[model samples]
Target: MDQTTTTTAKKVLCIEDEHFIGELYARALTKGGYEVKVVIDGSEGLKEARTNQYDIILLDLMVPNVTGMEILKQLRDPSQPALKAKIIITTNLEQKEETRTAIEQQADGYLIKAEVTPKQLVGILDTLN
Candidate 1:
């Protein structure tokens, strides 16, 4: 029998306000062979997103200090032009208008948090790769 090993782990940034949700996602993603970073504060998450390159970012819309829309705007801004991380909005917000706006802002994907389990989320990320 032969075994294959992966040399690199996919990096994931989870910007979620709920501590339990964050931990759940981090644990699930880690189990799925990803390097996960969870930030409960939107401002700090935004700062980190702007500075580091990740394979994917799981963002929540209603977070403390800064809105996820604002973070998306900054990340998609043509002025910066260097941030290329794929951003996926994982929020409980269920508004068609907001979804449209997120799509317009170049969000890679959107998911209703209430509808997705951590394992399902990992499956989605796998498709992206």
Candidate 2:
């Protein structure tokens, strides 16, 4: 008799407002064997983040309804259940001080959207573990 084994794909949630960017990441991640969910609205993304279980979260800073920073703040709050997933900030903004603050606030990693391609993002995720 022959038996087959299957491995579960890692889950990733991408919170991005730009439709093209979000789709690009989603397509790449899906191709890389990850189950990817893209949320275009920050508020909706935050709700999904709190409710769902994911291995990693790709968050964009300047999103509508709720900013990624606010979502990170809430996720890091001691009062909330510890967010078990790694949170990586994906943004085009290049403010040095803000980057420092995000790192200080417990962001697992940060990437500039303009500087990273989807394949590179996958490489980054691979190094996380």
Candidate 3:
């Protein structure tokens, strides 16, 4: 008898308004065996995220139409259904200490966009699983 093992790829949603950054993460994550979806607008991203279908959500603090902070607040609100996806705050914006602490309290992980490379992002996701 023969046996085989298979693992389902983790689905990732990247909410980034920067085209270059979004594509870069998407390419690297896809290469790392993750099913990656990139949304350029915060409103659209939030809509997709509300579906609760992704395993991870990489949220940029400065997206258009709606801010990532707003999305985070809505998703983490007790009024909504519990979210199964790990929300990682990815941004280059420098926040006040109080704001940062608030964000950190709700997010699974926080990464500065300027400091992390695409490869490093993939590595971080690997550890999350």
Instruction: Give me the candidate number with maximum lDDT.
Output: 3
Higher-lDDT candidate of 1 and 3: 3
- C-alpha displacement of 69 in model 1, angstroms? 0.5
lDDT of the candidates, in the order given = 0.88, 0.89, 0.94
Number of clashes found in candidate 2:
0
Model 2, span 23-63: residue lDDT tens: 99999889988999999998999999989999999999889
lDDT for predicted candidate 3 compared with the true structure: 0.94
Q: Which stretches of candidate 3 lie over 4 Å from their true place?
A: none
lDDT of 3 by residue, 12-129 (tens): 9999999999999999999999999999999999999987599999999999999999999998998888899999999998999988988988889999988999999999999996
- Clash pairs, model 2 backbone: none
Model 3 poorest ten-residue lDDT run: 98-107
Residue-wise lDDT of candidate 1 within 19-128, one digit each (tens)?
99999999999999999999989899999997888989998988999988888888888888667689998888775786576665688898999899999999999999
What's the distance in Å from true for residue 82, model 1?
2.9
Give the least accurate 10-residue stretch of model 1, judged by summed lDDT: 95-104
**How do these models rank on lDDT, best leading?**
3, 2, 1
